[model samples]
Target: MSPRQTLTSLIVGLVLPSMAAVAAGKCERLVVTGSPDAPPYLWRDPQDPKHLMGANADLLKEAATQMGVKVELLFAGKRSQALEEVRSGRMDLLADTPLNTGELESLDFIHPPIAQNEIMVWTRVGHAQPFNSLAELSGHAGAMSEKTRVTPTFENTIKEHLTLAKQPNLTQAFQQLMLGQAEFVLAGRYAGLALTQTLGMSKDLQAQPLPVDTPGLYLALSFNSACNDPWLRGQLAKKMTELAASGRSSEAVARNLELWKAQLQQPASTPNQ
Candidate 1:
């Protein structure tokens, strides 16, 4: 080789290994999970039982795509189990986590929450009474899904003045309200709407206009994850900020609501396939 070609080849040989190492160290893929029953936010994909499909899943996937990272949103059983998986470092990310003191210790929450959820009261249609605030329901009996978590203040209020029952799921909570067993059911507005529509109970239930609590839903990374590096966290936070500003996160909810409706209309797939 000529002297000039030899010099260029030597330079290339020295730089390529360093570049490859850096690329290899970067996080290329993340394993993510979340609540398997929250429709329009997250739920198991009927067609693909191993994965989840919905608004939060879509938003997370889009954000990761923009960051040139592949994300696998999986069905990790119940919401509690999903959180545990992330907490144990078995999963890299929790897609739609709500801020709570208990979770902060085991997970690093990405800033600029991806979505805000309104916790609302649902009462049977025609049975609704004035509910301008949570205080108005103080003396009333309420039902909530067993997995639902409320603010500390709300929990105190329940302990002090409210009579609340925890049901196995939101459907049971709503059923209690419908049967007049409970005066109201506390649930996320979109989730309640999705359930009502799917169960053909839309005409029977109404959500109070006033939200009891508005909680921001965040993306959480397990501290033990190999990919839990500053670059990965910062990139995710930046993408989430952009998504929040573009209003696409809200749009994702609306879009997935329709998607959920369409999916439910299809005939049920046979089990044990």
Candidate 2:
């Protein structure tokens, strides 16, 4: 064969496959939904109404980039609305959800936990401890969100003492506690600390780390969505593990905590009010 013809054939062979691979990787934009109530976990920035930039938001943004996907944040009015969006295929990802049997039919959860949350009790600065043991919460009044899940003994015991309220979000739960409507409230340590600071209640409330329970938080994808992309999930999982191993994730968490502390020191102004 002539040298020019040989070179032309080789170029076509390489370019055609490259073009095919690029087309295959192209994905439709995805929407991630969460309520504005969960501050520092999944809350909107007051300064940027369209932007969500908390610890969980940062983590998910990193994960999506690593997975080669484009995502937009959809702030639901309530947690139930967010869940409904996911179930109906209106949303793609739901970060930081606990494993719930009811959701399994419509959702496929990622395997390893993206994060773990230490459930703790928050009370007024000088209030007596709500319960000495997980068993002790059986009869007392405590506030927990309708969507929160308490595992094992704590779950069963708290069921009786719980007062299900229509606060609809974590921010409202904190408000309920502040208004003396509930004896105690349950929240993740990192999340609760950040929210308390954001709400300017650090001096008015105290977080007492309880040994009641801890739950692994996972990333959830809707089964009904066209983008049920496990390959993307795998990429994100690997990147997250790398971030955790290199201590970058921890550093980010610490930096966010310091930022929250500084926010707490500022004069109180409600971000979403």
Candidate 3:
């Protein structure tokens, strides 16, 4: 072929593939699943129907934007449903899950924990005596979410006293506590506090630090995701490191805490306790 004809062919091949790649990128989408019940972590605001606004949601959105990906939020009915979505490849990512869920076998997690969640004992104020250890609560009624995983240390011990409440959300559990249906509820500190306030039960209940379980939460990707691109995980990991180093992560957590405190009408000093 003539030199001019060969140059024209090379230009066409490069430009066509470049345009095709641009089109393909536009079609790529990220689907995230979360439940509205996990306040301070994942919750739905009536003002924003399409958006789930919370600490975990904000962090995931920031990470996605930083990686130049488009995100779509899906509301799963429960934690179990969300996990099923990830396992079935219906959801691409699950943000803010405790490490003990045994989810690692079906998902790849970003390094560096997203947050530390403490499992605290919530009881009606002046109703039950505070206990220093789980053993002290033996034979007393306790409430726990269905299929919830506690650390092995407390799992067996608490199981003996667990009442197996069927409440769908933390707010409901708090309501149960107020009505004398449950002696105490087991939940994360941030979430339990948020629900107690939102449901107008803050004055009726209080949470004490328990010697239960605590675990690091992580952003995880479904193993069956169509885009199992290792680079995406690397990018997210890098962004998380940057956020932590810049103290942005801490600021975000503090901001969320403040919001929850205000919603609960509780004193900011309560966080220190």
TM-score of every candidate relative to the true structure: 0.87, 0.71, 0.71
Q: What is the lDDT ranking, best to worst?
A: 1, 3, 2
Evaluated against the true structure, the overall lDDT of model 3 is 0.69
Clashes of 2: 0
Candidate 2 lDDT, tens digit per residue, 1-273?
999999999999999998897567555566887655454455665566665555666777777786677878767656677788889998887776777877899987776655556778777788875554655555555676554555556565565556445355567787888998876777667766767777788898777756457776667889877777656666667766776576655555666666555654567644331
Candidate 3 TM-score versus the reference: 0.71
Model 1: CA > 4 A from native: 1-21, 267-273
Candidate of highest TM-score: 1
Clashing pairs in 2: none
Per-candidate Cα RMSD to the true structure, in Å, reads: 4.2, 5.0, 6.1
Estimate the lDDT of model 2.
Answer: 0.68
Provide the lDDT at 5 for model 1: 100
Model 3 per-residue lDDT tens digits across residues 94-205: 7777655577789888877666567888888886476556766666666666433456656665656554564655656666777788888888776676666656677888
Q: Which candidate comes out best when scored by lDDT?
A: 1
Residue clash pairs of candidate 1? none
TM-score rank order: 1, 3, 2
